[model samples]
Target: TDFEKEIKGDMLSSFISEVRELVLDNCKSNDGKIEGLTAEFVNLEFLSLINVGLISVSNLPKLPKLKKLELSDNRICGGLDMLAEKLPNLTHLNLSGNKLKDISTLEPLKKLECLKSLDLFNCEVTNLNDYRESVFKLLPQLTYLDGYDREDREAPDSDAEVDGVDEEEEDEGE
Candidate 1:
């Protein structure tokens, strides 16, 4: 029975706003993972997980009060459809660095009308011309686009090549 009140939990309900922005540079893996963050915090405004091995985030209850969310890096693949249905209050989302061959898997997030910022860095994103147009066509509230930036990392194109994007430019950008 090593379980006791050795550590007292903080009350997130009293917080004026719950904005958990976890921005790390480089986190290799989630080996030996432990308990997840209990978001009982009513004031939770923002939540970010940068450079962390966050594979799957299940049971994301409705956060009508949430404003911003940033989750970059780590080996997260699949189940994006489910994620889009949840987390309605997210305004800013950064999904950079991961194994994303097809971004269409994440189109579900377009339902988030409050979404403003979106980042998809080094995600093997193909068909940005099509994808970008699709997103712009769908999500009317989006403001800042991430991949189209000149400083964005270059992804290898297959047979066809889009203007304003070249292998040489990608090298410089990356």
Candidate 2:
């Protein structure tokens, strides 16, 4: 209901004129397809379409100024390649809980040098072997994945004993 009203160019143009953030969570676009809506928000820096039942990203309009986009909990199966090509300035993206299953689907994201944070939690691709390493290699610019940062993923094991603690002294202290 709200999404339909928002997608109307005249209405959206008037609404967008006053804000840089567009939140359309839980509002399905026409026919579960995402088209013609994004072009209206040319100046938007943040856009959220969470749980909108989007089936594809093929028709996503070029958003030159958009830095953060949230498409979590949708039905998107693929199209990240087109997304990277279109939104070269994007820095943060959330595709969690979608139907994405292949890590190769993310290959095009390597072109997004500005992308720093990506969330793919609950997607089938997370189950793949070496998933974290693969994603890290694919998007070297990413400092955060899901909710974890680079240091969190790369931190050394914490089970190693301290160098200077003697067994006898440790036992005595206890």
Where model 1 places Cα greater than 4 Å from the true spot, the runs are: 1-36, 59-62, 126-129, 147-174
Candidate 2 vs. true structure, TM-score = 0.75
The residue-by-residue lDDT of candidate 1 on 1-174, one tens digit each, is 233333223333334235444233454434513234445544566665666676755544445566766667756664566555557777667777866666566667777767766666767663466766555656666655573423344423322333334445334554
Tell me how far the alpha carbon of residue 157 in candidate 1 is from the true structure, in angstroms, after superposition. 30
- Model 1 per-residue lDDT at 74: 57
Off by over 4 Å in 2: 1-18, 32-36, 153-174
Worst 10 residues of 1 by lDDT: 155-164
In angstroms, how far off is 12's CA in candidate 1?
Answer: 7.5
Clashing pairs in 2: none
What's the true lDDT of residue 49 in model 1? 60
Clashing pairs in 1: 18-43, 18-44, 18-45, 19-46
| Residue 162 displacement (Å), model 2 | 32
In the range 106-159, model 2's lDDT, one tens digit per residue, is 888888888877889899999999888889888888877876665574312223
